[model samples]
Target: MKPNLIAARKPEEAATTHPTILRTVLEYLLDKGVQPFVGDSPAFSNFKRVVKVTRVEEVCEELKVPLTPLDDPIEVNGEIFRKIKISRKVLEADKVVNLPKFKTHSQMVMTLGVKNTFGCVTGLEKSSWHMRAKNYDDFANLLIDIHRIVSPILTVLDGIEGMEGNGPTNGRKKNFGIIAVSRNAFALDDAICSFLGIDHLVYTVKNARRRMVTPEYEVFGSFSSTIQLPSTVSTFERFSRAFSRFFVKYPSIDKRRCIKCRLCEERCPASAIDISKQEIDYQKCIRCYVCHEVCPQNAIKLVRKLI
Candidate 1:
């Protein structure tokens, strides 16, 4: 995707990184003599270019910290994935500090620290894994496997500005006004979920709990209203109980809102979306919602697929 085309399509959420908070962390890292490389690969190709638009590059540059692009891929020889490529910097890191914005995800239910690491996979490899897994549960397993491999030393949830609705990317930003930190992502995510009072059916949450990946965690702060959940979160438990093939939710594009940018088509891991026709083929869609996440115009909507 073109860097100019990949601009932040919506208004900046108040809960996004505050200069003071980010500076505080950077100062701490610098004081500790920790050489930090702050960078993230966006949902599309050319992360170095994408970061330029996010303006995160400016922050890193001002902090005098190196912004490392996760462009170089390193093959991961692991169970379930014979040859999955991850970012070289992640592998080289002595310690990984996971910083994830609290957002409700269309597929994973929530994009917490565990799900945030998916960015480390580099560009199209992220889409390839979705196509390979093909099922949400299997995809969740793939995420868990990658997390185990990367094994971030710390996880910090930037819930001060969180997103709900069809998110991780395209959603209305809410001021969640909370920051959570934990050594374990699973625990931190669970704590965040509990604080939100949302259901526990999140794929990463379920998988993490089942594998006993979460240690004891606690929530300190409180919020007035409960966070709104994405429409796709309901299928978590029902997915295993019955077929409900027709009851599944699928991503639909709003042509009026869509700029015909083809971002959805390019980012779709299942290759189920055809922007030319302005339709998503549910038969091929794994409901991964990568299209929804990357759509620069917020054109994609999750609607129930009626039989």
Candidate 2:
């Protein structure tokens, strides 16, 4: 998926669920006779090794919970999808508890409950969806479709330490000091967006509201701080309606900064990236920001597409 740049923060500080919170949830599930399996497909193919470095393996071991890697894919049909591959274990589970980290996403505007479930799409299949849905609107719809298929029973947002600006992976950490839980992830996500002063018209929010998928819910906590949106979004906001109507932003590889690792090229869903020439085929590019997210050297940058 992507690499985290903040070296000062531990796994929790880097917008992941705190070990204490995870332990509490697991304990509650165990007490209720629900066997909980700590599992997810990490952004990269080497899910096992990455989890260890991120301390997920350690945390699961300390809590005596089995860690399962979501590598096995199960093709399932949805309203908007024909043969999307999702994790088999996720499909087999009686109930799913979503643990989403509150963060600003370059593509989705923000990554909340619904966006987090995209991990169920398996490693490369997650990228392939980007190929199909090239823009925010279609991508958001794709995410909603997958979420509908998974239908997690509960969603717990890790907002205690959240990320703002360019995020989901690379961004500055903010002490949001909040945790939200709900049976309806869409409602919880909407509440979070409202709290952060982000526009409800964001693709996910708009779609959820349009479909009436968001359930009735009440927010118990309040925060007054405004979040810093990604540069691409904030830049678009500064433009007048006329100028903004035509501009598009696409990722560019900083030739000077790239180390030729080809991580972005490999993860690219549409196969538009060429590491040898360090060029991205904009025609085939999906604007998913996977290139920017996976660039280990911080080489990929989002630039406005010239019309």
Candidate 3:
């Protein structure tokens, strides 16, 4: 089987390299008559906005691959998930390739191959999921369920330059110039966790393992190279558990970085955030980390505390 390849590059180098990335993936799949579709649910609240910000449409056009926007909901696991939708084009395609950006996640620690599929859920549905899942374990289950259904034939990580500290958005960018790919999402993510020197047990990747997703799964080619990431930080899950906090290490407004934009509060699903005083109500908090994930200023930090 031809292995799916994930390449890494700096976001600043996008103009020079995105076309190559697009062409390589599209042609490889298209040559086998396997339809290729690229999609991601960015932290920015809307899929279209993500596309615009990433210029994915231009990349699709350049590669002649079709661009699909998933907007209809589908039921999974007896849950009436109105936001759980997938691209029809991807669903119908013989092969699905996932292109995910590598970055730190306030809730999950890092958003890599497996977490990228959250984009398949449509519009406000992504935010609603935070409320539905409520806690770390339940939310991890939801993510696993989505992965079970979407089941990308291949996953590629965009780790050339990824976010760290507080990420998925609103964090510092670091250069980890390596590309990785694999047939199995679990294996792909496992490799990334290893490369980053993070304990798989501390990440959702470990949660994936409890759900039986493992690194032992078959892999295609070896990673092109391993890039060094910055110094490590505690995963929110670990911080929450160790600190004995009901707050679950949710993002708190960094008054130094916050511009008082209210974006985090507006987008928060639990409405646990108070923008007026820039305070978070830990009692009402759900630990979704959406505020941290979506903050424009990277002003949110996952701090542990009890209500």
Mind giving the per-residue lDDT tens digits that candidate 2 earns over 206-226? 787777777788877675667
Model 1 misplaced regions, further than 4 Å: 1-11, 14-20, 218-225, 235-246
Question: TM-score-based ranking, best first?
Answer: 2, 1, 3
Off by over 4 Å in 3: 1-10, 13-20, 43-46, 78-89, 218-250, 254-261, 304-307
Worst 10 residues of 1 by lDDT: 1-10
lDDT of 1: 0.71
- lDDT of candidate 3 over 132-182, digit per residue (tens): 877666776677677767887777666666666655455566776766777
What candidate 2 gets wrong by more than 4 Å, as runs, is 1-15, 237-242
Choose 2 or 3, whichever is better by lDDT: 2
**RMSD in Å for all candidates:** 3.7, 3.2, 5.1
Could you tell me every candidate's TM-score relative to the true structure? 0.88, 0.90, 0.78
Q: Give the alpha-carbon lDDT of every model.
A: 0.71, 0.75, 0.61
Q: 1-307, model 1: which lDDT tens digit per residue?
A: 0011122432264323443455567778899989887755565646555555556666677888887666699999655666878888888888888777777778887877787777778767778888788777788878888877878887776777778887767677888787788788888887777666654567878777877777876666655557767777555434553555546677889989999989889888777888889988877887788887777677888888666
Flag the better candidate by lDDT, 1 or 3: 1
Which residue pairs in model 3 clash with each other? 6-180, 8-179, 9-160, 41-119
